[model samples]
Target: MLFFTVFELVAALPYSYSEDLARTVAQLGALAHCSPEVISAWSCPLCKKLPLTNPQPFGLPDFNLSGYTGTMGTRLFLLFRGTEPESVINWIEDLTFEMVAYPHCEGCRVHAGFFASFKALRGQYFDRVQQAVSAGKEVVVGGRSMGAALAVFAVLDLARTFPEHVRVSYNMGCPRLGNQQFADWASKQLQIYRLVHWNDIVPHLPPRTLNYRHISREVFYDEPMANFSLCNDSG
Candidate 1:
């Protein structure tokens, strides 16, 4: 078992939000949910010309992740798929509320199920990400739902190694993955754009009463394709 002691909070610099970038990232995240064939054939206007390579699907029989690693100009990207509607395992992972010690950081704990899913694909994803960093490219990670949680974990782990290269993470409908200690530690390590779409219940899950908390800089959209507000971390 792992345990942690309180660490002083370090104020993170505010991240500059760009709607265009967010839309592009969101497209990549959605593309992650597609089948391998679809992903290969994908011809979206936003990323059609970008050279996306190293496409692979990873996970166990019970848990799976569909994503790809690619680069556009100077930016390297790792995008992950969200929960599949018919995946019982995915829902099971989502509902498993137990908190386990996150060994990578002292006093950091994360949702057990989310961590499990992440572990299944961590090695493969890390290897590719490491290669990209070695090639001197800035990294951007993004995902939706459970994939978002996994992205958060990847960002933290990546930050441990290539702190300068692990640029930022863009997550949509992300649930709170860890306790305050983890959130505090993560906030200072990297810039995270947690996008919450108008009262989406997933972001509110495993409830704060259970000691789960979110990281800083939440981007909240109140209406469909309407204006968005940058929320304070307190929520």
Candidate 2:
């Protein structure tokens, strides 16, 4: 497989790559638990840009790892929910800080509790992604905040099974998901784009003091103007 460092990839981003789509996807991920009727009514470039319709717009009913999914054009989206009140409680209650090397991958260590929750919920959406891929469709996975953290885990696992099928991932205001080694490894394997807001304090959590590190290729924006600046490996 080929790998581009964060700097190289960002430099090559096309003008047509649509930051608007990225923001919309992030919003969808943040609202994963919202009702289907609301989700359907909310217009986004996913359908307008791609000219596809959602045959099935389903969201995970379980509160713990609730996520939303839908079909748009030849792309399948798997979006995870962010830190709601219950998720915050989970973060506080499960404060063991245990780190284990991710299975089937070398030199990658992740938060045990987060990884466990992601693994449990992943199977629920993985099938749909696989089905879409098998039918020659692209798969885009993303999330915001805590859901962004979970989405990273999902992409790491999914890449092993559907390398070519798994396309870009949009992580909005995501917390650090793993250690330096894991970040480096995941960056090389996936086209992961992290979006961070200047005033958004959530991305700074789990602390690097805990040995957590973010992946490469960040699109940062702030304040009055949401114009984005691309960064590499570092926020």
lDDT: which candidate is best? 1
Off by over 4 Å in 1: 1-15, 43-62, 85-94
lDDT of 1 at 186: 82
Ten-residue region with minimum lDDT total, candidate 1: 1-10
User: For residues 10-129, what per-residue lDDT tens digits would candidate 1 score against the true structure?
Assistant: 333545665656766787776776667666665665447445655555444445665777677677888878887567356755486899999978999989988877878787678878
lDDT of 2 by residue, 1-235 (tens): 0111222223764222356557557555655756566556555443343333563444445645577677766678888877774566566455556788877568889877778878778777777887888998878888877788888888878878898887578887787777888888887776788888777766776678889888888877755333667777673
Q: Which residue pairs of candidate 1 clash?
A: 4-107
Deviation in angstroms for 145 in model 1? 0.6
Which residue pairs collide, candidate 2? none
Task: For each candidate in the order shown, give its overall lDDT on alpha carbons.
Answer: 0.75, 0.70
Residue 27 lDDT (model 1) = 73
